[model samples]
Target: METLKIIKIGGKIINDTVALQQFIEDLSKLKGLKILVHGGGNLASETSKQLGIKIEKVDGRRLTDQKTLDVVTMVYAGKLNKTIVAALQAKGCNSLGLTGADGNLIQSYKRPVTSIDYGFVGDIIQVNTSLIEILLKEEIVPVFCALTHDKQGQLLNTNADTIASELAVALASSFSVELYYCFEKKGVLSDMTNDNSVIETLDLEAYHTLFQQGKIADGMLPKLDNCFNALNNKVFKVCIGNPKMIVDSNSIYTTLQL
Candidate 1:
């Protein structure tokens, strides 16, 4: 099986031009099939605030109201998506920016109101793996944004981590997938305040201990879940680290194993 590298980049890197550019440059050098998924919540929230759309979250997941949906759709699918594609293009990577709506690549259902009505927020139901296979076979790098559709003409605000994990899981049968989650922190930290406090190797037991001790919370909580889910579903490798770790073999980063 050929190797596939699925990279999910978020946090400060999404908004910081220098970091994003550096990431694309590194991405251009990666071998075999590659995919890029991005999160631009910081930028989305800023844009929403400027537009007077109230932003809300429940347990690190966004509560996407109608107004917030419009903001995120425009920000995630439009601005951030194209920006990534264009950057990769300049770096000599043939990148194709896509949302779940594009070619029905991902199908999801909206969250039903339970304790919270997450508005247009979606939980992925299916991924069209054949389309991805076609793209990768054609040597077209797919750049995905955090947006999905119901196949009913409604765009939903989906989580980028979820998208990346689902894609990795789906592609596992045909490819040796390496799932990379690049974020602001170098890796899972032993101390939150210390940026250099990287926990290089993390397994489920250690993760549970830290999690129960409340070492991990907020966005990281679900993000870690996604990482484990991918590993369990046969993703060949899962790494959480700074952007440069994607290119640097000896770089300090968190390596997750079951």
Candidate 2:
């Protein structure tokens, strides 16, 4: 099987033009099949504030009420996806910007009401692996935004990290899938205050320990969850780190192993 890399990038990197450009250049150097998934949470929040929409979150997952959902759709599926695709095109990597609604790439339903209602947030149900494979065979990179839809015509906000993980798991049988969660930090940090405190390797036990101790909280929580899910489901490898890890073999990064 050929190797496939699914990279998820978010946080400040998505909003920083220079950093995004650098990431695109690095990603262009990576050989073999690859997919890019991104989140524009910061930009979405900023846009929301500008439009006077209240932002709400519980444990790093946004509560996508109707108006907020509209903003995220525009910022995520519109601006960020196209910008990344245009950059890849400039680098000579033919790319297509997509949402879950596009080509029925992903199908999800609105999260059910539980302890707290998540409104229009989505829980992914399916990934169209055959569609992905066809794009890969055609040498077109798929750039995904954190937006999914119900087949009934409702768009829902989804987490990019989970999207990347699920895509890796879905395609694992056909390829040696490597899932990557890249952001501003070098890697998962032992000390949130210290940028240099990267844990080079993390397994399930260590993740549980840190999570219990509250060392890993907020946004990093869901990301780590997706990492383990990918590993447990047959993904060949999973890494959480700076985007440079894509191009640099020895870059400081956290490797996740089951």
Candidate 3:
């Protein structure tokens, strides 16, 4: 089977012009089929503020009300997605920007209200693997934004990490998929304040210990969950690290294994 790399980039990397340019160049050089998933939460938050939409969060997860949803949809599906696709194109990589609503690439439903009503938030239910496979076979790189839609015609704010993991899992039967979570940090840290305290390798046992000890929390909590999910579902490899680690063989980073 051919190898497929599904990399999800977020945090400060998305907003950094120089870093993103370098990332695109490196990605263009990667061999085999690849997919890029990106999150622009910081950009979305700033856009919401500019549009006078109050950003709400509970446990560091966005509360996507109607107005905030509109802002994110425009910022994520529109601006950031196209910017990355254009950059990839400039690097001679034929790339297509997409959202869940585009060609029904991803299907999800609104997150049901429980304690807090996260208005337009979505939990993904399915990924269009056939469409993704066709694109891969055609050598057309699909760049995905953090947006999903109900088959009923409503776009919902979806988490990019989940999107990457789900895509990796869904395609594992046909491809040797490797999922990557790249961000500002070097890797999963033992000390959040110290960037040098990177965990060399992380297995489920270590993850549970650190998690129980509260070493991982907030944004990283869900991210780690996505990592394990992909690995358990037969993704060839899962790594969390600096963006450079994806293309750098010697770079120090966290590797997740079952």
Question: What's the lDDT for residue 176 in model 2?
Answer: 98
Q: How many clashes in each structure?
A: 0, 0, 0
Query: Stretches of candidate 3 above 4 Å error?
Result: none
- Candidate 1 local lDDT, 1-258, one digit each (tens): 999999999958978888888888999998889999998759899999999888887866678888998998888888899988988988889989999999999999998899888889888999998988898898999999999999999999888999999999999999999999999889999788788989999999999999888888566888899999999999999999898898999899999998
Q: State the displacement of the C-alpha of residue 35, model 3, in Å, after optimal TM-score superposition.
A: 0.4
Comparing 1 and 3 on TM-score, the stronger one = 3
Which residue pairs show collisions in model 1?
none
Which has the higher lDDT value, candidate number 1 or candidate number 2? 2
| lDDT by residue (tens digit), candidate 2, 90-156 | 9998989999999999999999999999999889999999999999999999999998999999999
Highest-TM-score candidate: 3
Off by over 4 Å in 2: none
- Lowest summed lDDT window (length 10), candidate 1: 214-223
TM-score of each candidate? 0.96, 0.96, 0.98
- How much does candidate 1 score in TM-score? 0.96
Tens-digit per-residue lDDT, 1-258, candidate 3: 899999999958888989989999999888789999999858888888888878888877789888888888889988999988998999889999999889898999999999989899889999888988999999999999999999898999999999999999999999999898999899999998899999989999999999899898577888999999999899999999999988899999999988
Alpha-carbon deviation at 115 in model 2, angstroms: 3.0
Q: CA RMSD for every model?
A: 1.2, 1.3, 1.0
